[model samples]
Target chain A: MTGYTAKKAGYAIEYIALIAVVLIVWCVMAGRGTLNEIIMPAPSKVLDTVTELIGSGVLWTNLVISVVRVLKGYFIAVVLGVSLGILIGLSKHAERLSVLIIQIIKPIPPIAWIPLVILWFGIGESGKVFLIFLGSFFNILINVHDGIKQADEKYIEVSKSMETPFFKHIFRLIIPGAAPNIFTGLRIGLSSGWMCVVAAELVSSTTGLGYMIMNARQFGQTDVVIVGMLTIGIIGKLMDSLLRAVEKRAIKWNWSE
Target chain B: MEHKYIEIKGLSKIFTRKKESVHALENIDFSVDRGELVCILGPSGCGKSTLLRAICGLDTEHSGDVFIDGRKVIKPEKTRGMVFQEHRLFPWLTVEENVAFALNGVDKDTKAELVQQHIDLVGLTGFEKSYPRQLSGGMAQRAGIARALVNDPELLLLDEPFGALDTFTKMAMQKELKQIRKKSNTTMIMVTHDIDEAVFLADRIIVMSPRPGSIVKVIDVDLAEPRDRNSYEFLEIRKEVFNEF
Candidate 1:
């Protein structure tokens, strides 16, 4: 709670400074606002577009569609990544078998999967989710593996002395020990979730924040484009904050030292 | 006289590294009485810790039998509670939880009461919820001792339990240990290199020789209860154990 308050205080101060800078820039521009609205839109104009979209309920509809797809894809990615990472960590044979394949595949960016996802799943929800899953899986897997590898030897020895069951040892000690790293992976994966969803929408969707931006661009609605971009940023931040809250709860022992 | 609770007969351990054999312990035969507090003193790399580890059944490649209660120890169990040098309390758990961790598959009420009792036994009543990191060096060691004793094992194996502590803390711990032994009549075998620590705490100080280790001499401490370290008798015994090195 204290950390959140301190961060909020810092964000508020930054916003105040940002508003001051924008005001100075506005004065320098001196109302010579060109009708060339393709590249940049006025902040007030973007806000008005956001309000109009919200009032008409198109914003809610698009937001829900995008959020649902990202959630589904991101969760699948998290489960696969974490479980496979753990198996690889615990078993040397599994590690030797899969590490080379993972190294070869991880380099191919999630965006590059768009062509294949379209071919495999058609230009629909399935294609977009596959793209989002691809974006998140590798990062989460690597983090979980690293976290397990980094666990202290002494803790393992303690469990060994007690003769704790293999699964209990992993769940009770290894998982908790690797939690901070996994949380970091989740944060990164979730951001990738938004990017892949947006990219997917642009590639094949009729409705979504990405499609909203694309639709606005066709009509030269610069303010609506800015609104869609800002909404994406805000929603992405909310998901991250929610994950952080869960992380805090899980690793509450790490509150101070 | 009671038969020795622990009897090591020709115990030897040879470690093979790249086809080169290293002799860790060689032809060691030692015995301890049922109520004896025996502290083994030796130099670093002298296999003192290895001996303790072997007796605790963590080092299985070692030869010969380490008979505990006339039975060979093959693996660590609740029967022998060990207090390690570094106070290896689990970081995720508080003092109470760490102490009670080994008493699993028991009723909750019994576990809770035992946990609280042991926490109080080690003078950690107030620090029940404090994590290992939150504790001072001395306090953590005390918690470690408490954790070992909470099991109420037949043998308490201490591997340089207070070696990491400062001189003052070490003295205080020795005194606390004496009081605990007196109160409970617990059988303990501590491994330490400090001659003074051995003389001060042990009923019999088992002086161990350097590498390919073996018991050189067993100096009995015959001084009265609440031992006076400065007394002539204690000093004489200390000198005898020192000479065995």
Candidate 2:
């Protein structure tokens, strides 16, 4: 137990060391006037801006909006992606019919769809949600499809020998077999969704961290911009950590090594 | 005429890969009596595994008929159970869950009771909640056995089930398998490369040769219970089997 705790402490130190060094360098550079305050603000100034935003309730409001958008889009992507993935994965006919279209659309970046999305849905919540969905959907679909396709033939045989019912076979063998890959998809899809929401906000929005960063930049409030960027980073990490925690519990068998 | 419990007539498997066709098994004929432990012993690449798969109805492309208990084998059924060389236990499930994998339609209490009985049968009672990865190779294979037996299969097909274990563990598993067979009275067909394993476990050994696998010999083991490996009759039988190779 002590050894485990020590190892955890070691990791914590490693994580903090780089951030501390970067912060010290930023403080020194800004204090010495070696860096332009307009372009790169001191760590202390960014911290002060964070305090100001939090005090005014601006941070919480925008954070909630961005989080809601991400959740909405991510939920849709997961439901559709997993269902479609299983469909395609199980049926060769479905795979053959959809493969070419999926391949053609997959390579195109979500940012490339911004103009088309704006034209279709305008600069409203729908447009942003649509953009986020596009960004996350393909990642999830491909991963889930791959997961199902890679379901162990041996396990399938076991289920077959048992004469497992159709739905039981799918739920017990195929889905669980594809779980690790599905989790991978969810993680990547989530990160991509987060990125899409920020990009959409940046392109056309009056709220969200991306808008805050852009607005702050126009006024040369580099501290607020930095604060916005930091908020995005911190929130992204937190969300990923939350996912990882759930993953650890869901697939504890995978973590034996 | 007394019908055999399991019969394989003129079984042949040809694999058509790309442009070339390879003969895997050729005109394999065999019959296993009810509650008999039969082992198909052969060298590697002799299609013994393929033969087991055919009997298990996992391979339907073979050109022949396998009748089990007067019914024609079409596809896999709950009455037929198979254990592969690898434990092949689902890594996501605990030992208890793995054992209970095939008991889907049973009520919760019955399922749990059956799972508990099989776990105890396999000497894995204490480690029911442990995942496959957490168990040793032998333990995992025991769980695989438990899983196969959970459905009360009338026929159990094992393809090199203990071929991956160390010699000592293999011997111990062989003994455990004998006890299991005695208790269940289920007809068993095991494929193995180990001659001693066949000699120890099989009521009759069907030895095969590679390059389009075909049965070369049918040797009945008339030895009594707890057959000793070092005994004179055992060595004589072992030598006879080895000489056939």
Candidate 3:
């Protein structure tokens, strides 16, 4: 039961800094002039923007669209990453072929290909998803590759000594044995997928939180910008928490061992 | 013995690494009789482990064949079970699951029964649900034994199984092994450096020579069952095995 004790330092410092910043902003703005709509919309107004967007169903629709893009891009990345990872991780030939190619491609920013994506996929959901895929694919591929490469040789020896059949050995022993590393890849891929989605929407969509921020900038709706930013941060943090929870539950059996 | 369960004839293993050939085991001929407990004892680097590993078909480049009941063993199978020096239980699996791993294709009812039977046989009935990390070293080794014995192998091969345990635990396990062998009558081969352990557990002990290991001597234990370890005869035999060192 006591395993759930929260770490005090990181969260406490972050919360304290945020609170101090908000208090300073509020005090300075209130003392400087009467409450106004334009110059620095009160923090309360930003929160009100969130509720209004939620009540009107605008928030839900845009959130779903962004989520769908992340899912499609991330799912494709996982399939490609796992297969490629296993290949490169297991075989010297595959690793040699990919080592240089991955290095060349990995350093290029996913957003830098926005112009190329626009030319190929155009201004649609496809363009946004492709961008997201570029961001997430390499992260997953590298982790999966590392996992497979480092699988315990002793276990493999054991299975080989038993004459464990080929397919069963690969599927039951190799894959699951490398699962912890695969999970690390998954968490990295999913989070980076979100970063790509935001950049994708900014380049293409008229909907999503990224588009909302762009629109708010045009109309000088500073409060809406804050709401959009907060939504992105909160959702990213929540998704990370969800992934950690799933990982813990899945690996609990290993705790004793 | 004419009724030997296993016969290793003219066995030799060499490893070619970077075009440099290393002789691991020389042309060796040794045999084990049915229902006998045999131990291979030698100093470090004498290839005691290499010879044992070759018998289990762990060495692909080895010459000669290991025959069990008139059949050659080209690879490991349910007929031959092996226990390693480090109780290699899968951390992700519980005791029951680890024991059942070898019977991957067995029917569900039979699998369940065999798993439970082996767990009890190893004196780990209450710890079936525990993982390898949760158990003490002795308990984990017992579980490893259960996993090896679950399939009812014709022969059991142990590679320094109790070398990692403390003296007290090792002695207790030695007694347990004797009891289990008496009840099951399974032919057993063990590799160890302990002279006392060899005398206490083995019906015969094969001592190996230096590099390109071959059998130097095979000492027979003529002492009767439930043999007194403190007796002068037992100590004498134990000393003879140690003298080979």
Candidate 4:
């Protein structure tokens, strides 16, 4: 227990040191006037701008909108990707049927579809959600596919010889076996979805963290831009840590000691 | 002979890769009586594992018939439980969950009762909630046995179940397995490369030869229950079995 506490303390210290270094660099750059405030606002000014945005309810509304968008797209992507991935992964016929199409579409960047999405959905929630869905879906599908493929053949045989029903075998043996990799895909998919939401909002949406950053850039409010960027970073980090905690609980058998 | 519970007739398995075909089994025939323990013993690559797979209906491409209780074996059934060389327990599931894997339609209360009974039967009573990775190899295999037996299978097929265990654990597991078999009175068909294991556990040993594998000999042991492994009688039988190799 003492060793565990010391290790946790070490981690806290390391993070504190990193924050201190960033603060020092920001202070030095601001105080020396080495870079223009328009491009690199002082940390204090950014914090003040963040306070103003929150006071006016702009920051919270935009953050919530961005989060909602991400949730909608990510939820759909997970459902589609995992189901299709399992289908393709389990059967040679299913894989062969979709392999060509998947290979063709997966390589095309989500940004590449921005014009088409805007044309179809007319800069609405659907368009932005579609873009984020595209960004996350392929990553999830590929990882889930590989994860199911990586399931031990011996276990599959055991399930088979036990006369386990097809769906039961998948639920009991294959899915749990592929969980770690699926979690990997989910983490990657979430971050990519977050990226796509920002990109979509920048391109078309009227209100979101991305829109705030872009609107601030138009008015030369560098502080607000910095605040928006930092908010996105902070939220992303929080989501990742949340996922890590969940994975720790879900994959309890991974403790190999 | 006692009533035949499992019958394999003219079984043959051929493997083809890159236009080259290798025969894994050829014209093999065998029968296991009810409540009897039969071990298919051979060197590596002698189709022992393949034969077990075929009998359990996991390998259906073989060109013969396997009948269990007068019904043709086309696919694996709930009555035939199999244990592979590896423990093959689902890592995500606890011991109790793994044992309850095949009992899909069973009620929660009955499932719990039967799973607990099987876990105790396999001497894994206290570690019911432990994950597969947390257990030792022998313990994991015991969990595997409990999982197989929880469904109350008529025939338990084991392929080198204790092969990964240490010597001491292997011997202990063998004894535990014998006890479980005796208690359940389930027909067992085991495959092993260990001659002593076959002799110690089996009522009859089927010695197999490789390269288009076929049964070379059938040695029946009239030894009594709890046969002493180091006794003179056991040694004589062991030597007689070893001489066939």
Q: Go through the candidates in order and give each one's C-alpha lDDT.
A: 0.84, 0.90, 0.83, 0.89
Q: How well is each residue in B20-107 modelled by candidate 2, as lDDT tens digits?
A: 8778899999899999999999999889999998988898998989988778898988888899899999998899988888897899
Leading candidate by lDDT: 2
The best-first sequence of candidates by lDDT reads 2, 4, 1, 3
Docking class of 3: acceptable
The positional error of residue B202 in candidate 3, measured at the CA in angstroms, is 0.4
Say which candidate scores most in DockQ: 2
Q: Which regions in candidate 2 have their CA more than 4 angstroms from the true location?
A: A1-9, B17-20
Model 2 residue B240 lDDT? 92
lDDT of 1 by residue, A1-257 (tens): 69999999999999799879976675445346753456676666667787899999999999999998888889999999999988898888999999999999999987787788888998878888888888888889989888888888877766666666767788878888888988988889889878777788867689888899899889988888878888998899898999999988887766665
Count of steric clashes across candidates, in order: 0, 0, 0, 0
TM-score of chain A of each: 0.89, 0.94, 0.85, 0.93
Per-residue lDDT tens digits of candidate 2, residues A1-257? Answer: 69999999999999999989988888888889888777777777788888999999998888888989988999999999989998999999999999999999988887888889888988889888888888889999999999999999989888888888999889978999898999999999998899887777855899987788788889988888778887888888888899988988898888966
Candidate 1 regions with alpha-carbon error over 4 angstroms: A1-37, A165-167, A218-222, B1-4, B13-23, B63-65, B209-215, B243-245
DockQ, in order, for the candidates?
Answer: 0.42, 0.84, 0.42, 0.69
Residue-level error in angstroms, candidate 1, position A26: 7.8
lDDT of 2: 0.90
lDDT of 4 by residue, A44-159 (tens): 78888888999999999999999999989999999999999988989989999999999999989888888888788887789889988999999999999999989998888878
When 2 and 4 are scored with DockQ, the better candidate is: 2
